[model samples]
Target: MLQHWLLGSLALQNIGRRKARASLLIAAVAISSAIVFTGVVMMRSIETSMAVGFSRLGADLMVVPQNALTNITAALLTAEPTGEVLDADLLDQAHITGISRAAPQRVFRTEQSEFGGQGESVDLIGYDPGNDFTIQPWINERLGRPMQPGDVILGAARDVPLGSEIALFGKPFRVYAKLGRTGAGTHERGIFMPSAELLALVPAIREQTRKTPPMLEPRKVSGFLIELTPGATELQVRFALLSHLSGTKVVAGGSLLTGIRQGVTALLGGAISLVSMMFASTALMVSVLFSAIVTERRSELGLLKAIGAKRSQIVGMVLIEAIVATGGGGLCGVVFGMLLLRLFERSLVYYLTEIGVPFLWLDRMDTVLVAAACILGAGLIGAIGALTPAWRSSRHDPYDLIRGEG
Candidate 1:
């Protein structure tokens, strides 16, 4: 251990003696590491943000009554409540393949006794809280517990405050949560409740309207929101649904964002290719630079070997020098990368969030791990770069090395 420490000290001193050359090597490594670190973090963060955003978009496909009126172009996130109804047990009866989860939604459109002004239609959507994927995921703010019977979630455009009582169809309901702005017609102006609660409210709705509502029929729902299993293509799932169920039309939810998702995937591939090339070039530069460094210090190494130094000792000294320089550079690069990410958050990320686009950064622990990996990778790269030249120089005759002829 003592001999190793002494060798390390000698290696550090040699680095100090050639300050300009050492600085050049460190700056080069720092540039490469900074690019690599920033690219990887940004790519991972963007991918995660995209996943969360798309998942919150409700379902991959929506199944509605065959004759139900729908604007295929506009129904991306949450489809507007269509009056046509389908059997709630439709999916169960069909036993459709590729279906991971199917959440039923019941809609009751009324303009009486309540939340909206006189004659202004309001849509009340009933969802199974346990089976819901769409409505609850967008809840930006809510009370501290799960939504219960007699509780309601309001749309973004609703002025009702949380925990406040609001009457809908002559029945009082507690405001449980509020959804974020989803830029959809129905989602921005609808009310959501559990299916059981909505089912129980059917009598009150019938009393208020003084007539029967077709959508409130027993075991009926406005639509079925379908989530597909992994490796299931939307087209394939649609075909299966059409084959099994005769009176339904499938609306693809991801159709609008498919191009954006593809573009993001292409950008990720480009970023990885760029980083790989940068690392390759950096390794080549390190090898060439170390070879020159060994050539310049031939006589000094020869004298050390002539006295008592073993080849292992010589190699260890050279490796220590390379590791220290590259590792220090990697540390500095990480700091610079952090600053870059901060700027990115303040600028582009802030703007996107303001425009309602989701953006999530890597967690602190993950950032630390990536930084540590970069430092270790830099040190390993240095050692590999210096190994060949250092070993070859050590194997030459001491007299030949001293004469600078080998």
Candidate 2:
């Protein structure tokens, strides 16, 4: 026990003596660990956000005009503008089996200048409040009251303040509530209101454009939001809709966000590959650094052996020094990584949005796990790096090393 204590003290003293070199090694490990931590946390966040957003959407399928399928999908997923209109009477003509509820929506694009510097055009969704199950729950949770004629609800990403009146088509509408971040689809950038109010605004819009009145005629809808009954599958409802509805395309909810999911998956793959490369490079650096340190301290190790120190003790001492350096650095890395993620979160989201990918930051539990994994991984790397150096030093001939020939 005394010998072990002496060996530990010697190792610590040696680390203190080479403080600058030790700090460099620690920094290298810390940087690598930080990259890994951030990548894992961000990827997990994206997945979780998608799951939550999809759950909240609460739709089993979407039915759109056959020619407007691509445009409608883009509008719903990426907030892109759509010009397609469908006959609202299609709801009466098509009755899908196992469908418990359906809501029709009229989609339009707000003028670019009306966004108050948002840079991107906002999608305006007009829904029948009485028939809507999709947005009603969110509205109830957020506003606690039914939507009035002039009320508008903004999506998660809108910077508009609650109760502020925003002008659209020469008329002002009050912002009733702002939706929570959904992180997956167009709800993050949409403005929802009752279809009657949206239809009423069409005249003003036409007057502003100097076109003939009634550009958006009454009873014209863009798409249908569908909900299935209990024990009914989306596939079953989809087939029924396709069989009953003519000139319309029915898409399952799971298939709606395929493009965005693919993009996120690609981004995650690239991030993982980059992090793996960083880990490999960091491990190689640690190995090279410790090997040099071992070569430089050959005489010291030899002196300890001559004084009856066991080979295992020498190996343990080297490993302890490496671990101590890396462990401290790993903790710092975790902190740095979290800070980096927070600082760049908005920018990251914007970039992903531009590329049409979904992005989300990790929640508390995920962040903690990422930090722990990074710190532990750093320690493991340090131990592995020290192995070769420790073994070489332990096997050295004490006589030759002492005479400066080892």
Candidate 3:
């Protein structure tokens, strides 16, 4: 009985026989639904890449020269550097906290490259291989050999390939290895070397370089990377360290990431809401078209009712026609949106890479989410468009509709 109501010959005839209405309804939905899905997928892809990059650092707190994170994060995430220097002593002081592991180093921003083809601006990080709190293992990779003072490791974002010779200031050093992708972050844009090697490359650097002149002295270690001891809460240690550091600050990854994500969420929510409003208006237009068509066929409906066809059955027939029209539109929109994303990715990489920002790959998960959203959005809009026609058809009086008389 249910199948007969939904799949009846009459319901099927209504859609195939009406070329103009079906085309209009489908076109309206396809454009609006595609815009909605595309916006959401792009926002999520970039934000998710940033979060993953932060987690990969494996450090609880980042210590940079005062106000350096924005610059540091940009340099690492986006490739732009900012911040003044702090005393290198802070690195030791952070380590003395008895509850943290602190890694300290100097970062020199310059057009330094390995196996030089064209010079690319890179953050050349100089550290004690023996005491790096983060990124040292990736640099000191054992697969080939341990990094010597003259060695360098290109980050995944580095344009140079592995085992290439990179020269800075006329001093050519071997590229020991490449670090794994930190997903569109700074490590990818940097060249890591021992502090001794960095000093040897520059003449103005070797003199008065007490414990080494940081890329900017008195600014010493730009900041310390802090890892709390096991079983200890990050917030608990953060407060203690801040109290001790006084002029210096300790910020947690959670605080930074949360702020950025919230800002993005608000922005995306605003955009989607606007698009939804537009979709609502378009759906109403579809409603009007279907409503008129049903009214024009009122005599046919009345005749069916008189012939013992239920009002409910007639209403279902109108709704099914609307659903079929919108569903096909939804599928086409999803496919078109995905193809557009792929076409634009190459162009996007140029701008992102130029600024030292990480690349966010639009993978299978993103595709699935986008497709589901398109399908669901069409179903909801189709249901709304069908409502008026379904109600009007069901309410007609057979005598008024058929006899051409009230």
Candidate 4:
């Protein structure tokens, strides 16, 4: 134990003696690790953000009347005010397998009624409040009370305050909540209310417009947005829907977005490969530097061996110096990487969110774990790099090393 303590002390002293060179090695390792850490965190964050955005969208599959005119973008966000109608009882009768929850929507345009303003359009979306999964998820602020009849939830663009009253088709309704900006046209500019309330207003809306859309008919709906059960693939659910619900077309966004997910995954794989290559290069650099260090200290090592230092002790001392320097660099790299991420957040991520783009950072625990792994990896790299050179120098004859002949 005493001998080991003395050797450790001597190893630390050797590092102190060559502060300039040691600093250079530490700096090199720090820069490499910092780049790797930052790239991984950002890539993981982007993938996570995409997943969140998809979940909050509330539907993996959208079912509409066969031959009904539809917009692909609207299916991904909120269904547009298509006048096409379907039997509201279809969902109950279908009994499709793999369906966890399905919410019905009745969409109507108030362009003729001039609801918001003259020549301006407002989409009135009637949803089953009990079964709804989409609109509520994006709500930024709302009244604390449960949503009741005669209550209306406005999109993010509407300049309305909660608890205020607004007249729809000449009847007064209370403003219930405002949704967060979703960058979707319907979600940002639509008005949402319960199906029962919207149905009750059909008479008043007909009186104002002199015509009722097909979707406004009794026991009719524009479409149904569906959520699948766990372990159920989109294709499986889609086939089930087609088998049961006749005269309906299923729009599966998962199929459309699969390519995007693959692209992001590919990018992440490439980033990992690049980081691995950089670390490998850093390990090689450490090996060359330590080899030179062992060569230059030949006489010193011979003197220690002549005084009864074991071969293992000589190798351990060299390895200890390498580990300390590389581990310290790894810690500094994590700190610098965090600062870089902060700057990235303030500049790019903030701008994206302001423009209503979705982006979420990795959680704190995962980030810390990644940092720890980087530090451990650096230490292992140090040990591997110093091993061969240290062993080679320790095997030489003491007399030859002292005479500067080997």
lDDT of each: 0.83, 0.72, 0.63, 0.83
Q: Give each model a TM-score.
A: 0.66, 0.52, 0.51, 0.57
Q: Could you tell me the TM-score of candidate 1?
A: 0.66
- Model 1 per-residue lDDT tens digits across residues 301-377: 99999998999998899889888888888887888888899899999999999997889898888878888988888
Per-residue CA lDDT of candidate 3, range 1-406, in tens? 8657544566667776877767766777777667766666776676565544433544566655455655324212221245456677765555545354566666777543333455556687766666564575344233366556667877877666567776675567787877776554567777777766765665633432223334545336566666555445667777777766766666565544434444554666678788778778867877787777777777887887787777777777777766767767777777776776766576775677678666666678766977887777786677678777777667777877686422
Candidate 2 lDDT over residue span 1-406, tens digit each: 9877877788789889988998887888888888888778877787666644543555667777776635333223321235666678876776556776678887676554255654457677777877676564444234566567899988877887788889876588889988766564567678888888887777787776565222157867778777665556667777777888777777666544433544555676788888888888887888888888887888888888899878998898888887777877788888888788877676877787688554556868768887988898788788889888888778888876676555
Residue 75 lDDT in candidate 1: 34
Model 2 residue runs over 4 Å out of place are 1-4, 54-257, 345-361, 404-406
Best by TM-score: 1
lDDT of 4 by residue, 1-406 (tens): 9877887799889989999999998899888778878877988898787656654655778889987777666335566577677899998897888777788899887775445677578888888878787787777899999888889999999988899998888889999999988777887888899888888988998898888778988789989888776556788889988998889988876554544544555677788899889999999999899888888988998888898888999899999888888887888888899999999999999998999778989999999998998888887788899999899888988877787645
Report the candidate with higher TM-score, 1 versus 3.
1
**90: Cα error in model 3, Å:** 20
Q: Where does candidate 1 have its weakest 10-residue lDDT segment?
A: 71-80
Ranking by TM-score: 1, 4, 2, 3
Worst 10 residues of 2 by lDDT: 72-81
* Model 2 steric clash pairs: none
